[model samples]
Target: MNRYQSNPLSLFGMVLWLLSPGIARADGHQVSDPMSLARDLVHRMTFDQKFILLHGDLGVDFHTSKKPSGAIGSSGYVPGIPSLGIPALQETDAGMGVTNPLNGRPGDGAVGLPSTLATSATWNIELSYAGSDMVAREARSKGFNVLLAPSVNLAREPRAGRNFEAYGEDPLLTGTMAGYAISAIQSNGLIATLKHVAYNFQETDRNFYNVMIAEAAGRESDLLAFEIAMGLGKPAVVMCGYNRVGTVWSCQNHDLLTRFLRQELKFDGWVMSDWGAVKAPSDANSGLDQEAGAQLDKSVMFGDGLKSAVRAGVVSQQRLDTMNENIVATMARQGMLEKHSSSGQPAIDIKGDTTIARNVEDEAIVLLKNDGNILPLSAQKRLKILVVGGRADFGVLEGGGSSSITPYGAGIRIKADGEGEMGRRYVDYLPGSPLLELRKALPNAEITYTDGRYPSMAATLAHQADVVLIFATQWMVESFDAPDLSLPEGQDQLISAVGAANRNVVVVLETGGAVKMPWLHDVRGVMEAWYPGSGGGAAISDVISGQVNPSGRLPVSFPRREADAPRTTIPGFDKADGAMFDIPLIEGADVGYKWYYKHHSNCLYPFGYGLSYTIFSYSNMNVTHQHDVTVTFRVRNNGRADGKEVSQVYGLFPANDGKREIRLLGWVKSGLRRGEEKNLSVTIDRRLLANYDTKLGRWVIPEENVMLVIGRYAGEAEIQFPLHLQRAEFSSLDMVKPH
Candidate 1:
């Protein structure tokens, strides 16, 4: 003190520290060890303080004078307690990128980034990691310590409202990509939250719908993907889904939350409730650490409900204590309490973001068909192109909801008429159409466009054009499910008219998920340009014009007929059923390819199925382990041009214990040049060999030979490899106790 008194600033600091004990604790010599500091802070917190710490601290922004307020004072930022010297943790929603909040102001549009489907298409884990890092940097700059992202849910259904937010359908692919995203976000000194914890595939009646999945199906198809994601990502927080299951809602299912996620999977993260997902007091019994997006407009009260539950003995104090400990631990681990000087500048570089986004877009476009080599449209003057359909000019390229990201002001606009009308009514919820970009990409060609319903008095125009391109769009929104897989109202009619009128007709589908293609046979070429994002228009033009070869694969199975879908039997799907809709997951884990292959149902397109401009060959399939197999293949660009090919590997365990069809073990993407071949290897694990036996209530390995298949799609390149399994005393210990 005497030495400090010599310096005026030191003396003032000493006085300030002495005057405020809270400040002293906050400014207390920086603790080099975060864990020890966290322990010390926890040891000093009172039970009530601990409970508060367990609750989520949400904010509209940092400096607003609002206090933990949302609806009815329930929606506000969680304040830091000066007495306890505990800083509130900040969290933000970012499955794709940082979504700017929409203030109640005119033209306060939401910013959107590329869809998860587009990100996954890049097949570049580093790009996803970079994207997550950029998002995390923005969040941290705004005082957020947690970023809820890397939605690992399998894209089981194409019509799913949230499919664009998740990694594609394959478990291994989704898992690997999600892992990179998690690492990127967490690496930035923030906690990453993997969402919709368990089987949350479809959004149809998501909140109250019951998923009646068989244990086996659930494990192999849906749960296997999540297992891979959880193992790789190792997120700091897990978000429970709102859907209901056999005995309980996913959010309130203790067997799923505590036993399965925490125990078996070894998920050490804190569990948070989805917005307004907690239906009753029992929901808290699932060991949920925090109630997020708590609103006062709803009947679900947070503070009072929690406190009353404790008072009424519905919730044990120990359980509450444990939740609090988890929350505190997560906060401490993220270093949320530590304050730092602001750079007062953007954390992410815009140029770098654009570069990454463009690169990802180039990789995601899938070229389904290209007949007569019309593509890579020659730069000749004789070519006359006619682009039809309202969507062709102005279609929604990205999905809606939390993941939506709008780039900064006046982005690269395409020159097109009627594009503005597409946003007249739904301006707040649509993406840029692909027409302008396509026209720009092909400046030398004569491009004509129409905006009315397809098949307008445009048959004459179509016949006159050298080639006719029809863009078909489908609209699927949140809190609602798609009615069917058929192309939207006038789309099929237009395709039929245009195809019949012109011999060289190409169909470009701008849909979020799979759609029934009744006009498949009529069209000469088809491109599934799924919600391409900001650069979607360019991507579509590139693929169609042969500038970029389509490498995208179907993440989920495409049903040939509507009735073939697994959820066709779910009652109340088409009818209204209040808050409790009858949207049942009757198919269980056998979704997408699993369901199709298991039932041997005919599909329009199998999972991981996609056609490229060039041809590829699969060969050299071999088994490397008693339980695992390595399928080596050569991807030859048979065409005159070079392209990339995704080699898929499928595994089938014999139905010794009445098992279902073959399952997808792993896949690899190979790049090739014209007339060049590349070697690829895909391995399957022993765990994937085990099947869930309901009779025995355990995962058992039957003493039977397993079959392994390698091809571009399911049941395409058929091969049989048998592995003998030694039967042992298989106990239901893991199934019953479940971690």
Candidate 2:
């Protein structure tokens, strides 16, 4: 018989091969390729088995767990196929520690790191790494292998409810910080996910709004931030947003996924849809690999319908195989498939984690204004102190949303009778309190407290105290945009009244993002504590009592007025009650400080602006160019105490270049003793000098010469150096280090 001819014995062998899901390659060969391994597994999987991997597993212990809906405790679980030897995947929410999975504190308790905005304000990249590592450890301790964290989304719109979850307004700063966090999380053996892919700036119409942004504009701003993160972090997964990009949902956008992310940016990771985000079976071919949280609510985005679609050739086998390969390949590369089967929770050090959280909070406390130097309250003077408003004794305010972290102690429950969905939730108040900590630090002094319910009463009380600490807060949640930037609930009026009553007034703002400070000039000292974490209380005491020097800088500009921002009126949907409308990103590259630079507008506090207990001066600027360019300067701590300073370097391309403006080229943080000086250098990535040339399909050098400016903040450069630009075109931000 011919070798190609099939007999009874040959037919039996072929059937056996097909039945064995663990068999080798189709050609009876083994290849050492990750993709090949994934493909081999896909070929053996049945349509039903393949469909199961496309959605979450109904294994979350929600009924027994205390976590609220949409919280980490309610996060979905996915079971693996035992026959295929794939272990179950346990996922959790956020970089701010493993969010209270039970919705409330469970056992010995977990740590809550400072909000992402607070961490970013430090302008210290190493802190990002440290914070991520600690959080990842907590995730492992909770028996989770995936961290849905390190949101690289830009704070493009100040009112963006999730602004606290993002890094900052600028792409360079946001990308650099997120990259470190992503790398650190993965380094701890957990998968890190970069989220809310494109133009997810507003929460008002998040689920149905369409972002009609120009492709080129998108690439340079928010997309640029994601690109930097993807190149540096190489995260295992990319979570698409709930809204549409242009006309299609981000989860089902072919251009965004297959064309941009997969082709131009070279992201090889699998794509996962945001909870209840996938809307059609055709989305299977458009880059959505998994539909998350589907089993929780029994949503039927992908199940029997997907299997039928595949069988009928609506979604080709090639597309189905591609999805399976992406998922399996990512799991294999991350070693998730190998070690996920292990049992027992990893070790967690509560005290150690608290220390990390405190350190970040201490460094992130921005001293926006210190008019009379009334801050660093002298321990030698025995004086009366008054702490007003914001439930300082209760807990620090945390941003509301999925990123909200439940601390280690008693969880605060809200009354649901008169509250909205975002308002009626638990607030975890751990071991620290600003009021208690402040009282402990000033034992000899008489400390008084007030709710500040009556402005006149509070103002009268403030006048009697030797010093006043007014704690003002504003809440920002994910489902809606802030009504305005001003301090809500008459806090601004209270602050203004108190400032008028006492010249020694100090305002401690516990907020999610920048707030309009009408009392900025009247107060003696101002602190922007952007949602400091569980240990925020102790950190605040340290800064006020002179135990720690203030080093945090403003990551986003505090525009003098809301109108000073890029867009005064963010366009409304203008559609029917449930219909979708489009909003374009017309700002282009002129975002944040760039907009201020072009408009020459006066901001209340520019990006990178901050004041320390000690003063620093910079001089001796020098520049050198080779394959890369470097700027060196001497930073001297010209004061009586040691402190840290973040030196910012900016670049301005020639007008002849396609885009002409000042950009944050590089930055570095330095700590020095009083009167000590250090020669520090900041390197400018050659990629920073170029813009994405869509037509050329590469980053092109735009100018022959670039001007370098060094200073403590943007628009306030102390020195300038001109440097020559070379290497016209290239790709890959892996070679670039902006910090």
Winner by TM-score: 2
The Cα RMSD in angstroms, rounded to one decimal, for candidate 2 relative to the true structure is 10.4
- Report the C-alpha lDDT of model 1 over 372-426, residue by residue, as the tens digit: 7666676555578888874556544455555555554443323222243223212
Q: Residue-wise lDDT of candidate 2 within 118-215, one digit each (tens)?
A: 99998877777788888888887777777888887787787777888889888878887887787777766677889978778888778778887766
- Give Cα-based local distance difference scores for all models: 0.63, 0.76
- Minimum summed lDDT over a 10-residue window in model 1 is located at 1-10
Residue-pair clashes per prediction, in order, are: 17, 3
Give each model a TM-score. Answer: 0.84, 0.90
Q: Give the top-scoring candidate (lDDT).
A: 2
